[model samples]
Target: MNFQKNKDEVFQAVANATEEAHRPQNSVKIIAVTKYVDSSIAKDLLKTGIEHIGENRVDKFLEKYEALADLKLTWHLIGSLQRRKVKDIINYLDYFHALDSVKLAAEIQKRANKPIKCFLQVNVSKEESKHGFMVEDIHQAIETIKNYDKIELVGLMTMAPFGADADQLKDIFSKTHALQKELQQLGIANMPFTELSMGMSGDFKEAIANGSTFVRIGTAFFK
Candidate 1:
């Protein structure tokens, strides 16, 4: 699998989804997950018009960040974060995609120096292998998180069930979007949930069509 070929495929997927969605005002953002690869691949992706990449581990991210600090990049945390690592992530990361627990959220709120953006990871798929706050627990977690002045709840993020078709993916993405709306109606309007971080290299186009602003691309960028 050629990396460049895969990148082209992901780029096309994003563009096609954007055109199909017909939301002329909004463009989809693809955060390429550059996990464990090198900075050269990141630079290649940047050259191909990708400006953001997610890293699962802080240590690995730092290794790539050191070389990429000079380049314009947005680092997103797409991994389950431990309490001890919150301070370190707070020091570097601009956005975290997996704030799945309220306990962890509190720690992040305390450690966050600036107004850091966040995505509440919801277990829409309800899978044991995945890490996220169950759908039923999300509202209470969001309510608790709303009090933190340092963290801004941007939207909901979800990892769809494996082997899911396009239709299933759309439903999950739409569900995440609806969750955002429910939160807004509950007087959480000051910080509107504008993003639905769902989808990946596999079913991202469908997620986009139904409404997904941030797509965490992994295998597509890492081929």
Candidate 2:
């Protein structure tokens, strides 16, 4: 695949969608989900001006982390993390997009050497197949994790059910956006809830229209 061309196309799409949505330019960060590609492709992506890279598994994340350790890139761990793996990969990540439980937060607090930027994953759709806090539990979850100094709750992350239509995707993203606003009003310290990491390759435009700040794209960038 032509990584540069794909990267340009994705950026163009993001720009057009942002303008169509009346959102500010450069508002959405495109996290190239590098889980499916090898480190060589990831290095090529960095050369194309893609600064943010996401990996969903700890083993693969570390593999690429070791291979491309010299490049200046913002690394994102965008999958459900097992507590046991926290100590191994905590320091390498710039953002963790799947913090859903108090136990995990406590583990991160115990293991991280510095404040880790985290996006609490909310299962906004209440889908049993997804891994996140249910919508109703988010407020309490936030309250419980407030004392964990090692974690900086940056925002909420979620995925719409696969095969969802545009309207369905919009509803999911809009609801998550509203939740982010609600959390921000609480004025929790270090909780600058400014991001909404919703959307994937299929529904990113709808996600952008509904106030997504980061969109994770894999197939679009690799194909």
Candidate 3:
């Protein structure tokens, strides 16, 4: 596969979408979801100017972390993190995109040797298969976790249901963006709430239109 060509195409698409949406080109951060590929491919992505990479599983995350330790890449843990596994991976993560519960937050607070940026995951689509706080409970969840000193609440993360149509995806992303704004107004200490991490390969254009600051892409880049 022509990785550089694919990377250029994705960047161009991101630029077009941002322009159409009237958002600044620099506003969106494209995170290469490296879960589907091994460290060898991930290293190639770094050489192609991809600075952010995400992995969902702890085992694979660690394996790649060791293999690619020489590189200066930002690591994102973008999966449902089990509390028991937090200790194994917390120190290595630069951004934790699946902080769904106060229980998990507490564990991270107790375990992390340094402050970790985190996105509170919200189940905006209310899909039974997703792991996150329900839309209605996000406010309470935020309030509960605000006291965690080691976790820096930087933004919110969510996933639109697989195969959802454009309108559905837009609606989900719109509501999540609204929630991010609402939380920003709360002025909670240590909670910047400046990011909305939504969108994937299939519907990132819709997400960019609705104010997604970070788009996690895997399939489009790997192919």
TM-score of candidate 1 against the unseen true structure: 0.90
**lDDT accuracy of residue 91 in candidate 1:** 62
**lDDT scores for all predictions?**
0.80, 0.92, 0.91
RMSD of 1: 2.1
What TM-score would candidate 3 get against the native?
Answer: 0.97
Tens-place lDDT per residue, model 3, 1-223, is 8889889999889989999999887899999998888889888876788889899999999999999998889999998899999999999999999998889999999999999999999998888888899978887887878888898999999999888998898799999999999999999988999998988999999999999999999989878
Better of 1 and 2 by lDDT: 2
lDDT of 2 by residue, 1-223 (tens): 7989999999999999999999899999999998888999889987899889999999999999999988889999999899999999999999999998989999999999999999999998999888999988877887778988899999999999989987888788899999899888888888999899988999999999989999999999888
Sorting all predicted structures by lDDT, with the top scorer first, yields 2, 3, 1
How do the predictions measure up, each by TM-score? 0.90, 0.98, 0.97
TM-score of 2: 0.98
Q: What is every candidate's alpha-carbon RMSD to the true fold?
A: 2.1, 0.8, 0.9
Name the regions of candidate 3 deviating beyond 4 angstroms: none
**Model 1 residue 163 CA deviation in Å:** 1.3
Between candidates 1 and 2, the one scoring higher on TM-score is 2
